[model samples]
Target chain A: MAEIPAALLLLADARLPAGGHAHSGGLEPAVAAHAVTDLADLRDFLHGRLATTGLTGAALAAAACAYAAAYAPDADIPPSGDGSAGGRRGWRGLDAEADARTPSPAQRRASRAQGRSLARAARATWSHPGLDALAAEVRAPHHPLVLGAAAAAAGGTPRQAAAVAAYGAAAGPASAAVRLLGLDPLDVHRVLADLAARMDEVADEAAAAAAGGWDALPAPSAPLLDLLAEAHVRAGLRLFES
Target chain B: MGAHHDHDPHEAAPPAGRALRLGIGGPVGSGKTALTAALCRALRDEYALAVVTNDIYTTEDADFLRRAAVLPDDRITAVRTGCCPHTAIRDDISANLDAVEDLQARHGRLDLVLVESGGDNLTALFSRGLADLQIFVLDAAGGDDVPRKGGPGVAQADLLVINKTDLAPLAGSDVARMERDALRVRGGKPVALTSLRERPDAPEVAAWVRGALRRARGAAAAAP
Candidate 1:
């Protein structure tokens, strides 16, 4: 078995100060709508979300890991960084792909907002040429792309990046559910533990799909999530951004 | 996944710019929003300013500021806290930082930017990364004993405002004891007693804010 990067732990931790705490990963709206009121409904929601948004985000992160792995900080690249035109175009294309996958405008905004926050934290934590290149290309790179680049910066493989992405997809909302509903936190952990194997499976599938190239990355859609995100924006009283 | 990690105690100060960022935080109904509005009313004519409010459940704070007409509509922005107000202000200040930067970019230059936190507990305090100067407000009606409790806000905030002084008599709370306890915990930091309903302009707190702005400006200028 290959050794895992220690820095992957920091990437996976929810307390990295990257602004992930402010977002509910669509759980806020679900709770507000009474779609998820208890632990049982939460389990179902996580399962479906993991299968759809989780998988898509994981695949994108894996693809982004590939791009970031190719960046060599020691290389005597052009001062313009933009002069590495191919890399610039590549990152932009990946960001656009992420936008394409997210059908909800509100979700896209949230993703990009998170991406922007993660970009700041990632750059401050690691010195990776790919991160700077991506930042130059897209001011607010997609969250998954930043995760993937950060993973690569931390010496993690595409698979590890996918794992982190998939875990966050469910964990963010699970934590939010605990806070919003006052559910037993112990039971929430049990639910996350039960989904561990499935999360690994989704990450594996995403890592496998990543090899097919960015254009061929997963683009799964969850129409209900999209509608929920939009509805969250219009909510007169909301505790979450999306 | 459950292991605890110690956050760095030395928070890097944000790059000094044209504006001085002031953070106001305290418990619900402690008048953080009101103080922010009062500051806006007092300082808008003197300085190019804007406000960012962290609203936990609604945009009521932002809406109230708008209704008060202290600053123009575009000058105020609201950030949702996702039910964890402390996290937005202390742990992960990205959303608030985004709003602040957006305001600065829009205005080109601002003299002061007030970031009002969502009403939270005494344990809540602003991150040094988010605020150049922080003020923690406490209402006299909440409990005079609260200052004696001395959480991080009371102990570390640059300024402590013991507000709603007029209610002290009605609530049977001792205003002098609140100030004494707060000062005792604060290690000589300035504490102001305010009655916004009576003064309306928050004269003492606003004066303290003006002093803070001056000291911040002087520090920024002195930095090599």
Candidate 2:
């Protein structure tokens, strides 16, 4: 049997203790308010999240990581040593674009939190200077960006990075449903397995986005989800953070 | 709200990376906000301070702090949970974590972050991953028997506070009984009575936080 790399296993382990369990990724509010009820509704929710929020942000993050990693080995990249790669005005532009595209403060906070956590974990577990450099650039890194950078540092391909991002996104909501709706854990696993089986499709979407380059990247649209998120904020009693 | 100024003025400084985040949680009107305000006023000069507040709808708590002029507006950020406050602080803390880092980026020398959860029920408690120390607040107006009910927040918080002692006389609450019951459930962690309206000093609570912050900073410094 071919041996699996330890880094891959470490990155894939859901229980690695990076603190991913607490968030429902906005599903709790959707479920409690009947925005998402059963398997069919959940499938729609996951698909929407994947297409709009998940795909665009995850792809951008992967691309950013790749860009940073590609420039890692150059000794004279720039002595600014500020992790901005020679005061690359272009990087600042990219950061601004990301800030503009993400309208929901709640969503922005969630992405940044996950990014920082992933970066901190990667810094401790891996020996990649590029990942550390990327982490140092921003106070709150976006999750997809950090995940992409971490994957590169860990030697996983962009395809693998997308797979991890997609899986993490899907798994959060499915687990939340299991707890909120009292669905069997076995049933939640089955749903995740089904989603996992389609990783290639998800990865392809992410890769396509990466290939298009950051300037031409497609913007995601899920107005209903955004509206639901806004509504969830005002809800008096809810089980999830939108 | 003070001007939004970066507390750490040094450029490209390495992350200090100290501080243990402690979350303060309780039902609405239970004095979580008041307690947080008190802590900021008490601890700011001694320890580098930052705050993250989860509000269900508006940025009320953050706004309140800013208005009170306890901390700079930038140091106190509001996360509009748009859902359940628990999810942001406990379940999915990505947003809260981001808020913390943003504060750290602007003010890199932080020694403590106080996370305030939206008014929630007894079941609400901070996830261990998000908060090193969790303080659960119960108001005397809620009822004397609340501590005996033994929900997760009541039973598991690092420190449990019976607040609104000033209201206890009018509400006819047994503050001593509540303290005993809380002690019985918490297995000797610690419990304090707070009258935010009267005793702004809140020496006992402040002392507990000072000790917890010291221990948390020590642990962080020791991390490999």
Candidate 3:
């Protein structure tokens, strides 16, 4: 039998207890308001989310990991004392773009929360100097940044990192939907399985975007999700954050 | 999976030694923030205390505590969960953990870290990984039936608190029945009836926390 890479296993373990279950990815309000009602609607919602927010987020995370891996040899990325790394100019730009693309304040906060959580978990489980340095550079690490650092620290390829990020983005909301809409667990599993089957394609897109370099990153454009996210923020009776 | 197996040897060591983490959760307008403030006032002089508050869109809870001067601003950190309060405390606790570690790193010796979840549904409860003990607070304004409804917070929290007992009569809530249902659902896991305005000290609740901390310290000392 072939030896399983512990990094992959660790990243894939749903039970690692990273706290990914509470977020519905704005699907709660979408479902509550009847914007997403059935399987077909769910598929569309997932597709839209994957193409826009999911695609952008996965690419960013992959790129962040690639940057961390590429720059690992240079321990001066944060620039001692001055706190400015000439080599990190591209990464700074990418982080800014991510911030701008995430229009909803709630979504941005959620992403940061998840990012910091991933960073803490990685720090506790795998204390890589490079990862720690990156976390320190950004006082509030974003999710993709942490995922990228973790992936690199664990020696997982950029593709694998993107795949994990995509899976988590889709699976988290789908699981929430199962509880929110009272859908069957088996049916939710089916949705996740179907989503999982497309992991390679999503990973490829993310990988390609990352390879293109941060300067040539894609533009952000997911208006409906943003609107739903905004609406969710105003809806006082909401159960999910966006 | 390939990822988990590959990194097994590179994993970092567990936290050296730490005090018990306590989580405070409850519904909206349930006096969770007030309870946190009161606890700080009551425990700060005796035990080194740090607090983490989760707010959906702002740092209102942390701001409130800081403004109240319960502890220095550095002793408290706020997590903007963005969506569900449950996600910050239960689903994903990285932010919360970082806040706790930051406090401990700066203070050097913390006896307790209190995590207050943003106002949420009764289903919300802290994950064991995030908190050693959990407190669930509900108010008379939510009605007496809330306890009987038996959500995870009421059924599973290590300690349940029904706040605003003073408002029960005005709101037509039965504080006695609420207490009865809470004990019934919790199977004897201690419930405290508190009126933050009337009894900010809440000696009984404070004693419970003290006892829990003592037991936690003993267990940690015993660990190999």
Candidate 4:
């Protein structure tokens, strides 16, 4: 058993009210497409998501947190504090990388949309220069990157950021699954508990990958999630944003 | 309709930086969307305007506004509530705030912005963070006793609208008792009865909105 940062739990709480409740992270369309029907199918769905999109998102969060934790306010700029100019460039580069990895137009929009909402709440909550840099630099950052920055602002490490990101990737969709499928909430939690060990392994992998710098971060993509996200937007009746 | 002047004087004007936000809220099938469309159509020529619709599962409200063509298509944005309409308008307003800011950025200084809530229960009310003023609608057909059973929506909203007055006779709902009960629970907050069937343009409601805008600007002007 390893010690965890208290802030990590705070960041991972689905009840944080950062507007995440509106997004199903491709679960709605997956349910609609009948790719996820019963609890067993849900188990497979969570596993696949935890591996591909979850891992990639965790790596991005780790990288963003690392960037923020290492922020150095420039001695040169006084009031304007373009002080974060270097960090701004780093955030921009990472955002571009996120864009490159996101294959679907709809998924990209969803990522940015969630990111934008997270930034609004995070900037108010932490008031950190690194968050300022992220906001000043990018039009709209990706969801994982913003989560990582928020995690750092709340005094978390890159690994903790990775853990929270990976947790969100699993937890959000699991919550959505309960609502969409009418599964017993306790049964869903058991499925998530079963994935707990795997979640940690991926978080470790993401933190290690992030240490190799921006380009070395994981870029694993999920084609079905992307396809489903695109389908969800065009859906006439849907309960989720993604 | 402008003669009804029981607004809360303690309600100060919004800060100078943004447009005046008005929230339209009500129970399911309560004619909230109809009121929003009427307001837009009536006021678009009078003021720079835009709207945001908080929809539970779909973009139906936003789509209706677009189809009506009361305002330009770009002026309307729909926010999905993930099934909790009240949360979007009240507890967590990040998405609605973003939509409002985006509309302002794109369209410049809008005199009024309407944030219409997804159909919800009688207890739902917009948070002050989201709307400077709020209108709660109830269908006469829902039940005459709804007004007597005072919830936050019926009691505290800036305006309470009893809609579908034309159906009162067929539905056996008494508009007079509804109004009296509303007056009792509200302690003199304004209430209006509307029949969209006869006045499709919603003249009285539109007039009420005009009076609201006037006060918002008047307070803004009076402030130092």
Interface RMSD of 1: 0.9
Clashes of each: 0, 8, 26, 0
Native contact fraction of candidate 2?
0.10
Score candidate 4 by TM-score against the native: 0.93
What TM-score do all the candidates reach, one by one?
0.93, 0.65, 0.65, 0.93
| RMSD after Cα superposition, model 4 | 3.4
Residue A111's lDDT in candidate 1: 96
Q: Arrange candidates by DockQ, descending.
A: 1, 4, 3, 2
Q: Where does the lowest 10-residue lDDT sum fall in candidate 1 chain B?
A: B1-10
TM-score of chain B of each: 0.92, 0.89, 0.90, 0.96
- Report i-RMS for every model: 0.9, 5.9, 4.9, 1.3
Cα shift from native, residue B119, model 1 (Å): 0.8
Tens-digit lDDT track of model 2 for B1-224: 01111121211211237456879999989998889999999999999899999887567788899999999888899875544677667765666776777787898778888999999888998876678678899999789999999899998887788889888878889988888888778766678888888887677788878766665566556767
Candidate 4, residue B173: Cα displacement in angstroms equals: 1.5
Per-residue lDDT tens digits for candidate 3, residues B1-224, read 00111211211222338856889999989999999998898888989899999887567788899999999989999765636578778776766776788888999978899999999998998878788778899997679999999999988887788889899999999988988888788766678888889988777678777767666677667778
Give the per-residue lDDT of model 1 (tens digit) for A1-242: 46888888999999998888878999999998899999999999999999999999999999888778788655343323121223545788888888889989999999999999999998999999887888988988889999999998998988999999999999999999988999999999999999999999999999999877566788888999999999999998798887
- Clash-forming residue pairs, model 2: A22-B91, A22-B92, A23-B91, A23-B92, A109-B95, A232-B82, A232-B83, A233-B82
**What's the TM-score of chain A alone for every prediction?**
0.93, 0.84, 0.86, 0.91
lDDT of 2 by residue, A1-242 (tens): 22435685676676544546545787877886788888777777777777777776667665655555664566344423223323444344345446655777777766666666677777878877667666667766677767777777777766677777777778777777777777778877877777665655766787677755466555676776666667766766554444
